[model samples]
Target chain A: MLFSRPMIPIDILVYGIGLAGVAAQAAAGVLEAGRKPFDLFGVVIVALAAALGGGSLRDLLLDRTVFWIADQSYLITALTAGLVTFALVRFVRLPGKLFLLPDAVGLALFTVSGTQAALALGAPWLVASLMGVVTGVFGGIVRDVLCNEVPLVFSGELYATASWAGALLLIAMKASGATPGTSALAAGVLVLVIRLGAMRFGWRLPVFSARL
Target chain B: MLFSRPMIPIDILVYGIGLAGVAAQAAAGVLEAGRKPFDLFGVVIVALAAALGGGSLRDLLLDRTVFWIADQSYLITALTAGLVTFALVRFVRLPGKLFLLPDAVGLALFTVSGTQAALALGAPWLVASLMGVVTGVFGGIVRDVLCNEVPLVFSGELYATASWAGALLLIAMKASGATPGTSALAAGVLVLVIRLGAMRFGWRLPVFSARL
Candidate 1:
């Protein structure tokens, strides 16, 4: 009964958005992997991790069947996107920032979906918000980790913060009796705008190094 | 019926070994975190990840309840061990290699437990064997990744290889009708001996740099 939601039009739209988000993350993963001298297997592994790691963690924590495993479309989409990006990059000198916009879009979509999923499960407010942040940013963290680099989210400009803000807004809107569609749309837009604005304005969190 | 096994003496012994493995990984995590200038929270996070990451992943893949959440004893044990190591190291400069023996023991214990769990769930042979290796080494991988270093299991002296070898041996023994306890004991010893021997003899896998 966990995933027995009636597939209304809004649900279909959300599903499409989720697939797009997966594709975006997988493409970004391939780009990141290209920076290192990894083999084909390594590249695919990184791509899969980047695309599926966040949602998998969220589902596992919530004891839900993993989304990709429940529906293989997500897996196929990630793999196809990754392979295409890998092949494209080998031939063309694409700009490093080409993925920035799509990445932001993916972040917004994932945040909305993740928060909604947690709330639907009747999770506590704080846990729901954190799950949203995790789904929005953990993929990038996993990608960076696999590449043996510091997780970009931990030190980057307003990425997870943007996701968290939107998650909170989504919860607030829902509590204030907004329709689910309206709340989801508003929250997703907020996340996207904040992420894009942060990049454009070079906003950053304070970097602290504790001596202890 | 998943975890409905009778709590026989062997099960209790295995559970005790599992707890010891968790503690060992947690202590090793603290030692690694000491190298970085992380605060108390960061140290604890790293400790928990190193102690629980592997088993969590295995359980998630198999759709089983996460061990730490199902039993709080594992969480308490990891936290206590991490804090104790943290406190001890502040007063006394422990040798850098102090945790090696415990880490090896942990790898053996985790490999045996993980393989057994997966096989009980009726996972195919290859999947079950890989689950064992995942449980044996993924913690170290997560720890090194959080520290922004290449995974020690991927680059170090025959760590995951030893784990995989032991996992395969476990499966073969079980298939040949060996007693469960005997198979577990042999496999655990094999992993420990191979890991220790690799460390002492400087055994290593080929380090390849592919141009593609």
Candidate 2:
């Protein structure tokens, strides 16, 4: 016990938002895994990929210790969510369409979180905005790919666009000397609203029809 | 010119091998992109992703500036290879099987390079070995997923296994105080031989057949 390391306490507000994001993403991962009807191990793998994949990639790109490695709680949360989802599928009659709600929530939260992290790290506004979009969408892309689906970001309705909008807004707020708390709250709300609206209205980007 | 940063000279042997690896991976990426018949920009994107993705991920996790960002030569090499491959595809009657050779060579080189990088950064041997395998395979995985194919590493003949072997061998050699030159050369050769042999012999890992 003398050599035991203590758990590092994170800020409560950040932890709450991050936990919600993890839970939502992990649930979405479980749904994608079920589309493939992968085995238990594969389900966990996909779930973890969905929950932590983007943040891990972002952290790696930013040259920081991966979040799950630094804090075991995130991994535990993802695993629990995956298992609960798997069990729920066996017992409850859940609609397949239910996954999108949590997926949107996760995307919105991650967009703000990634952008904030980048800004704190001294990234240029443009790069920070791009990173936010990448963090928001990359995990879902990984999940879709692992399930043998073409990544939805390539064709999905206004996915990355929503993240980009929210990120740009965050950058603008920061430049205007807004408090971090106010900027993050407004950005998260903006992303969630845009994303939900896009899904509800069936908004989509026009596909290029020309052959190159 | 007064404000220009000096170009740092890299060890010629490492530079040669790394350049070859980047070119080979970029060419393979170009080939993969052609499967989707992507636009010129998409092809270039995938090629850059395939060439730099793995190393970037490794460098980020190791808390180092990405190699391509720090040294423009690597970027130039990857872009040129991608462009050359794109042009060649229009003129040459390349068999699909031709991709495997360059891919195998790239994997071998990347495995050794990744391990050496991790070791230099003071990572434990086990972590270094895993990093090596990750660097060797991540690019191809990204390429396949973007092209809407199941990654070959998920079911292919001894792909990760070869990289793991090479990485472990490198770690062992390094622990025993072997010269960096000897360790890297031996590890690279080991991976190449194993990968080639596996492909030639149709070696594959057993699929998990049990229902969960």
Candidate 3:
């Protein structure tokens, strides 16, 4: 490919991110409400809250039907994941260190998804990009709220910043006309790299305001 | 004069609610932050989050720049109240009980406001009415999340329903050509009466599901 053109299609990258986000939401839901069993409605509520909270907020802001509501598969997958988690918790015990990896993966992917959605909606690049960051991080914020923890976005790990960086990269790739897959790869790599780098180097965004 | 129409105005009720909500958020902020010396940013954040969380969410869901953001007065009042609470908490031995009174007041008022906004936006009466209930109660829900407590909305109380009933009253009045002010007053009184009645008598709503 010539330097003027790009590698890896943006569409493929976006598709990967979409699938990853769904999987991540399902897994997190399992972890959250799976420990306890309630009625079908209760279990589904928790699963959907964990999976769709951030996106629903985003769409509500944009005034659209929740994406998952339109795509029944996402809801079904989340329900199945939660039920399986509730049933299988006794058999599966992962190390605490490994537990958050799936969530992190989903966060990274969701950032890209949000950005893409924003761009498609014709929002200015910055707002679109920030919306992406919000999309990636806020579901967990709601999850934590429901779980009674100060949002992880507030305390540590260059999470929001990393999500923004990934979104920004994807946007740039879009501007440059990189293939959809290539762009998505660039975005995903951008997020994972920044996050891992921040963790390894103990990087922290200065707490500008104590309000959080 | 006649009992043919619902009594009380929602606008007056909302005004009272907005005022009370501002106070509750300020006090709750101090409590949530562990009685720390919150700078202006800290107190304002707490106050605004508590005061505006519900209304903003309702408006955004309705696609509007939260009333607080649109009008600086609400912001000023909320921040000022927060600052006052921060300063006063250090010297006065105010019992937490005082907070309940204002929170109750705010909740009743906001429920009407939410319901009215929804109706004005031309939503179905049912949706509009529910919106009012959401507006009235979502702030407390957010506050609970911030404070690391289970949401009062899901707990045993007639909180949202009181607001809903009042909202429905407002919508009904408006649909039948009642002036906005008159409709507001009736709605507000209805909310106040129901909420006050519930609190005074230890009223609770049926919980469809139990916490496991």
Off by over 4 Å in 1: A1-10, A205-212, B1-4, B7-56, B65-140, B146-148, B152-212
| Distance from true location, Cα of A52 in model 3, Å | 3.5
lDDT of 1: 0.83
lDDT of 1 at B205: 59
Global CA lDDT computed for model 2: 0.80
Candidate 2 segments exceeding 4 Å error: A1-48, A57-64, A68-141, A150-212, B1-11, B210-212
User: How should the candidates be ordered by DockQ, best one leading?
Assistant: 1, 2, 3
Q: Model 3 over residues B1-212: C-alpha lDDT tens digits? A: 11123323435645555766766766665555534333333334445567767887888878864465344456566767767766666566667666766776776677767877777678888888878877877766776665566676787757777787888888889889999888887887887788788878978887677787
Among the numbered candidates, top lDDT falls to 1
Tens-digit lDDT string for candidate 1 (A24-125): 899888888777665554566578789988998898889777776555577788978988877777667767787788778889999998998899999999
Per-candidate chain B TM: 0.93, 0.91, 0.80
DockQ for each model: 0.11, 0.10, 0.09
iRMS, all models = 6.1, 7.1, 11.9
Q: Enumerate clash totals for all models, in the order shown.
A: 0, 0, 21
* Tens-place lDDT digits, model 1, residues B44-112: 889999999999888887787788877778999999999998899889998878878878888998999
lDDT tens digits by residue: candidate 2, B4-74: 44554657876787788889889889988897869989999899889988888777766667778887888
Worst 10 residues of 1 chain A by lDDT: A1-10
Q: Is 1 or 2 the stronger prediction by DockQ?
A: 1
